[model samples]
Target chain A: MRDGEPLVRWAWIGDHVDELAHYTGVHLRLGLLPVLLGLLISIPLGILCHRWRWAYPPTLTAANILYSIPSLALFMIFVRYTGLTERTVMIPLTLYTLSVLIPNVVDGLAAVPDPVRQAATAMGFSTVRRVVQVELPIAVPVVVAGVRVAAVSSISLVAVGQLIGQGGLGYYITRGLQLDFPTPIITATVLIMLLALVTDALLVLAQRLLTPWARGKGAAA
Target chain B: MNGFLNQLSLVGDWLTSSQQWHGPDGIPHRLLEHLTYSGLSLLFAALIGLSLGLLVGHTGRGAFAVASVANLARAVPTFGLVVLVVTLAGLSTAPVLVALTALAVPPILINTFEGIRGVDPDARDAARGMGMTGWEVLLKAEVPMALPLILLGLRVAAIQVVATATVAAYPGLGGLGRFIVDGLARNDYELVIGGSAVVVLLALVVQAVFTALRRVVVSPGLRAPASGP
Candidate 1:
């Protein structure tokens, strides 16, 4: 047999476009599900804590403890119960997102200026209307900031699922390592970084669109 | 439920084994390797992050640039980076160290910059009025005031490195993770569980130690004042 291929070849990336697309789809799915799950759980929890006041510290402490658990260990520990399926991979990723997002949600809501909140109340808006209409609009930027961090982190971590034979761009990294072929590994690494950077840029753009009032202030500065 | 109990019992059994506790391939040796990898990486990251952060904070320039770059780097997957580096560098400690150092830098750098930037302007004015040089004002007044947050950055980086260094096992380096990988390969689920427990424990201990260090190092005056009735 001929000697093995070089560590990285641009031609191989072109040749494997279909396979790369499939893995990119898998990567996005795996990364995104956790962010959605975390947001689903944390938003209501954050709202509850924000309203109650007493619940915030303990809840945040618990989230911190959960965050400190190594993601790899958390993934393996779940394998016993989840049986090496996507559930095993997802449960840990979702928990990590919650750990990052809850505090941001709470802090964002807390940041609503007292006068603005009171002004909404004086206008005879119901509590739910005030929250959804007035408070949430102001809090969106901060909450979105948290989501941006969580989303990028989840995307990076989805690659770790390769250890348990889960999909994502990590497939190439593991496969290349096993075969000692550089092309797939290097190609996947660059692709994963690109995915992360592109997603981050999109989030920044979304934030700008959502908070148009800030544009005027920014220009003034 | 049964599987959970079984894993717990298996881990307990594995930990009780004196053989696993001592010798060349034992827990102590593995723990030492894990700590060494984490410590060296954190040290290197601190050196790079702190100096650059200080320069950025002092000059009041490049703060935004440094932060944007750090945020992007933070988004790079650590596992992928480690494997990629190892494939290029061969199966030595370099890849793990390099990857983990990259992982550790952002928090330290960001925190140092923020901490120094947050220093009280009044205190800075006082230092300047006392005829201190720019370097002296930064070293004496600004850094000390920023110590709490700077240490906070170090703590964050250190804990992250400790938790992440376990992946070094993949590249043929010895660490607490060896037990997890080896056990999984051998179908020894107990060893895997036990190894994970050790890693989680190490992370918690590191966090607690840093919390204690913060209390000791941060001046009492700088701490939040006690609430009075």
Candidate 2:
């Protein structure tokens, strides 16, 4: 948008390939590590809520409240304790994931038909074993659905971390803005979108491979 | 624990200072700007998303297109879009509004489509059997039934817009985000903390308002019993 400046200069991209690649890698890690950590935390917590019943409402309320906080505000709040480290960014992102992941995990588990659960019990399988080996498999499609949403959202949000100086691809976006340039902004945005879409597609594929039996159930729920 | 209390007090002091309350950049003025940006964007998003969702959901045609667009929209980063648009259009409120509306649309559209599409077939058929036209069935039977989810969609969109409207400040627009962004630039941690607290409070108030609206607007008969997540 500056005079004589093309929307994107391929020569600039070619020159900055190494820099772009580094940011891309950082972007993936910043965007995804929290999702992976969230899954670890959410699965057990979701199961607890599912089994106890009483815990779900308060737990959901807490997560929803946390989710409502803006990403930048959450980042700044955490900066008080976490300093300027990546932890500041990841902490809020992980918390945000809980609102999406827990419900999906619960719903996925609840989707297990009573008769199927009865059969699992009648077959003398222990509760833990039934949950892990029998129930979790049935829950994959639904949980994956939540994961897909969380992953894309997390990836997109990682850029907002730039305000605190931790934004991955977001750095280029801000840089482009400050310098009144469009190439980096456009390039970074495209890459972030691609990362989200690719990650979502991979999750869909993983769901298919994991739940071949659900082929008859039609496209993802 | 002491440090936490210290920070809280700092934020409180910042919030209460008389100097912070009166001027062009005052809290009240910025808060109004934030609300205006959020309100305008939400209105536009609702108009576009609701109408498109109704058309696609009613006919069952273009469902795939709607789903794909929603999914793709989810992947687009709000910050990136804002910066990208600003860089292209130069600094102005219009680009920011465009970006915020774009960010808010997918949820409303998807939820509206799904809510309508998910209406019980029996109810739809019953409406038709009673000599209702296509429009009548959609309006009388389908939309009323889908009211809860449609309201839910609006609520989600509203909250999201209010939060992202903070980023609209990055393009030199005035809003609550001015405090955070300016605070960061000037290394005023107290101001940053105070500003973030206000934004969080505003979001909560918005959430509460939507919850109250849902209670009033959604029919009690259609309301599902309070259930665990």
Candidate 3:
């Protein structure tokens, strides 16, 4: 940002359109993959915690400790094993999601009304079937609420991976800083924020579609 | 397995070496810088977030707006904010501080508002029944009742700030993150690992301090049952 240079050079964006699109794809991959993986891991872990109340406190404490470690630090720590690759970034991000996802999953399951559970049990549904078909469906709204938070945070955090040479849009931010230019920095920042918001909106829409019954009852979680 | 142990020992050696502890660029000075950045950002964030949260929560107004704004804030990337601020303003600690404070505010504000809002109506009524005014009721009854949540919010904010202030080093500002950023540039894995280890430790210490603070500050009667064995 020099005295005479414009804050954002429109011409630069025009030239970097392909590059921007490439990074957007990379950014989405870096950000969303961990969330997908985390959801897979959290569901079972959440079920376990919900089933055995004793498991929750320790699980939650471990997740909180993992969550508190900064993204950069975690990235560096993982680099020891994973090298300077996408795995280094995704592994930490996946661990980070547990803190948010596990709680939400457990809460979503817990929100199932007792009578609803009893009714499911009475209807000749097997234990596994009842949990899968009845309980989980009821839990969709709450689970999706957690997913929305996890997705947005994961997306934003993906940019910090740039410090370790893997951040999606974060690359441009650091590049812009090193080059003493503002256009890429502003552009990347806007895109990352846009990506987060858009992902969040999509999750909310998905929640609505998944739990049509919950539509007019106010926001999830 | 061997490589992992080797790296661990490397990190241990880096930590134990006395030379790493003595200079202006050493661990002690960097730790101090890290703490200063974290403390200052937390102070500003607490001031702004706490005051606004208290006002909104006590009045039972603007809860929705505060929550939406806080959630939106959470979506902003700390790295982007740091570079954007530094690129807009010149390279100085000011930009770093601004970014760090922005990162920390949302958690504190939302938690405080939620805490105060969650206070029992019966408690408020009892305070009024005791002839306390609005401010007195808020201070004496609502705040004390909300202390746990408010403290939780502060703890969250403190940990976040401690973590993010590391990014302050990206703009050539000094802190523990200086090691990670500079270490990567120099291909110094030892420095990177050691710096990251210290940061994780610091964050844990902050978490522990807050947990202990909660036990001391929050009255036993007001403390939630789940917090106890």
**What TM-score would each prediction reach against the true structure?**
0.93, 0.97, 0.96
Write the residue-wise lDDT of candidate 2 on A1-221 in tens digits. Answer: 67999989889899999999999999999999999999999999989988998898789878877887888888988899989888899999999999889988999999999999999999999999999999999999889999999999999999999999999999999899888889899999999999999999999888999989878777567
DockQ, each predicted model: 0.42, 0.63, 0.56
Task: Write model 1 residue lDDT over A104-173, tens digit each, in one string.
Answer: 8887899899999999999999998998888878888878888888888888888888878784998998
- Over 4 Å off in model 3, which ranges? A219-221, B225-229
Clashes in model 1: which pairs?
A: A7-A182
lDDT of 2: 0.89
Taken in order, the candidates have interface RMSDs of 5.9, 2.4, 3.3
Error of 1 at B59 (Å): 1.1
